[model samples]
Target: MATEITTAPHDGSTDPASPARLCGRLLGRVETRLHDFLAAERELRTRVDARAAAPIDALTALIDSGGKRIRPAFCVAGYLAAGGDPASEDIVAAASALEMLHTCALIHDDVIDASPRRRGLPTVHARHSAEHARNGWEGEPRRYGESVAILAGDLALIYADQMMSEASPSLGAAWAELRSELIIGQFMDVVVAAEFSADVALSRWIAVVKSGRYTIHRPLLIGATLAGRPELEGAFEAYGDALGEAFQLRDDLMDAFGDSDATGKPVGLDIEQHKMTLLMGLAMDRDRRTREFVLGAERDPAEVRRLLDETGVRMDVEAHIDRLVEKGRAAIDAAPLDERWQRELGAMAHQVAYRNS
Candidate 1:
């Protein structure tokens, strides 16, 4: 970690405890510390294996790329809500580790999606694939590039584990569980993509494992456990589970229809891949032409959007998001935390449900 993490100057009058302020503060600190840590690692790798360092270079570039920092923000909020020292280095490192884990997941996810762009930039696999072609590599350019991208994601996972090592044993356990579930979700994703008919139960399970627990519940649990307030686990779990699932559904809708500038990636990639999502599942069941269209090889973004709307998939998705957010708000209200934390959590839930970027 850096000797110090500097962020935009703030005063007490701004209510540092507010969700937005707290998120900004923690995200700023996490980025500063994360850069410092990666720089040191890069130096070490450069000295040991200069060629192998390329993966780490890619990893750092992805880190520097933009993200909402939602997972880390949730980590900080969990610590604060559970009455931990919000200013402590341990908390910052833990949150930064969660961000690193997210980086790993996204790198792998982009590869799985065969996505060309992310955060409005070339994806790691796509970038490396292009580089291989430019440099006149001997083997298949795509394979070489994907291989490097896989190594980069592996390094990121290692970095995430290293970041979490300083935290308590309980925190480490949560991190392990998250990674395991992520693997299971990825396996299920591959299977669903290749074989399964659209099944709502299967789709929801994917959301729960891939996005719900890994994205929110476990991160919050890590923070809360590190805060030494395990008693608040039940309420935060309820809140995290609901918010996390809603967060993912909203993302699916955005990737299907949102503008590239707003979502930071080209839209309709999921439709192009024919991945089974709740939105797609609902539409597939309700509309035959939509199912036939999406299941076939050719992708028509216009028709996908029309089906998404005409089949009421968009409205149903929105309704589910609203309901889940309400469930999270109720959990926040019932949690035995400070009133300020309650308000902040309510606001967090709102942001999760409503954010476009």
Candidate 2:
């Protein structure tokens, strides 16, 4: 929403639709499709009783907040780029399934991060906690809030699986692999975060499993598998790996500096929570004084800013961002891709590094 109008330059030969623009177009397509799917599934809302309304309400808020819907677009794009028909049932099924998977992840991520807001609105736990407090019927607000959020996240996971299962038979294998990767990746993320054993190597491992694979790679792979392309496998994998890291690194940057309106979460959540991000870990290892400053800083926003300024964490973080961009570019170059696909992938890589939201 920054009115700087940072549109990518294009010419007639580029079809007036750069890869980033095409990503937005494809995301719009999937968003409409998902809205229809949710409308059809709204019957589940009516089925739940009043006693369980909290979870339903939380889920509804999440659905309303929505997102970029990029994962499904990635799935569909990979499918079509590999010669799969857009109208094919398998393609639609995979795209829809990927969206559901993403939705499930968001619900769980909000809970794990203990985020009070998303999209400038109260997060599920925050909303439920407020409701509980108003009713004056709770023992502890935090306990009740967390419990409801946990159940809400569970319901989202169940619904995601249900959506995938109801898809066409041809997409079963793709769906299975995606779900498996998601679960494994999520578990790995939780373990790594909890243990605080995240160095650059561990961060890279978690990045591929937790963010890279599910967010980009697996979805693309599923789409390509649906298209029955044996040759494009390596390219798709490489694209996902690079794109996924780019996405996560961008997210880390956003957690540090993005506007609340743009990113839909409080800035500095990563610093406050002491999340083990690659940027922080790399900075810590590169400069002992920077590490000491970050460790010594208070959780207040002003103090955190001062620490970053005084110890050069911000500069170090910016350097790591540049490194990630370079790595992404190299991976895209190494992929077995033609001019059109390479251009698309390059645009995506750039977008990932430069994205504000």
Candidate 3:
């Protein structure tokens, strides 16, 4: 039987005691903590020199722009599902730290990809570059902008580490591993894109390390570790591995065929940049024409889209995502969680797999 998943609408419940409401409340608190922490940091920087806070402003703008907040959501959900105390502020700080870390990643990634926009607005580098150009800055506008963005990303990383400093000592190893994996995975992504290899195995490895483990697995485990339920690591690992692939597949599908308005970013960027995403890797494997087009010096996004549809690679990936989702759900189901948490995690799997943005 196909598993059914439904998202509950917000009922405006104020009772944090309710299990159904606890996760939602905690998520709200996480948002508040981020806003408050950033505000305080901004204020302190402004006191030193108003101009010195430009990087902080850049970070704040990106956070305010809007995101799915997937990492923090997973972290908090993992902690709560593992029966952590609802009243503990530890989870809030950890979750906020995850978000700050994500901000760092996005800022640096934009610089690396030379992406013009993010979340429906000009990216930090793009905005700063334009400002430099308008102001007739001393150095090249592009270089100046990228330099500022790098500094901003570095600052965000520092802030993330500061926030995580107060977390349980048990989190030290996990935190270090997660940060290193992110950096290494990002380097691998850049290398693969430049090489433009069609190696499915390498592509899959990059996806798992970069998107899968970093976004879902580590966050969940961090939450579980904080809750003193490290045993849940095995189940969360299985679940994260499966669902993370599904999440990346969905991302590829959206980048390939989704509307820019809905996605809040340009489409077909991976193809343009020659990034060997899992979808493109699968397409190359399934169709000779796709393989040739991708490897050829001149690439056409329209042609690739047609090949994906005509070759049924898109449909195949959709089916594959369904199977991965089921695999994730099974892992969560087998874990020794209460019925409510089991259901919550199951719903989360579906949400992550099927998200449009």
- Model number with the top lDDT: 3
Sorted by lDDT, highest first, which candidate order results? 3, 1, 2
Per-residue lDDT of candidate 1, residues 104-151 (tens digit): 888888888888888878888999899999999899888987888888
Model 3 ranges off by over 4 Å: 1-20
lDDT of 3 at 338: 91
Clashes of 2: 0
lDDT of each: 0.80, 0.66, 0.87
Predict model 1's lDDT versus the native.
Answer: 0.80
* Better by lDDT, candidate 2 or 1: 1
- Candidate 1 clashing pairs, residues 3+ apart or interchain: none
Q: lDDT, candidate 3, residue 6?
A: 20
Candidate 1 — which residues are off by over 4 angstroms? 1-13, 17-20, 287-299
After superposition of all CA atoms, the RMSD between model 1 and the true structure is 3.6
lDDT tens digits by residue: candidate 2, 1-357: 221111333333445444445444455555566666665556556566546456655665666675655667667656655666645655665666676666667767877888898877887777778878999973988778877877877776776666556655566666677678777767766676666553777777667766777777777777777777646667666667766776777787677767888887798887777777765666567677556655664436456556565677667666666776667657657765455655655555565567787
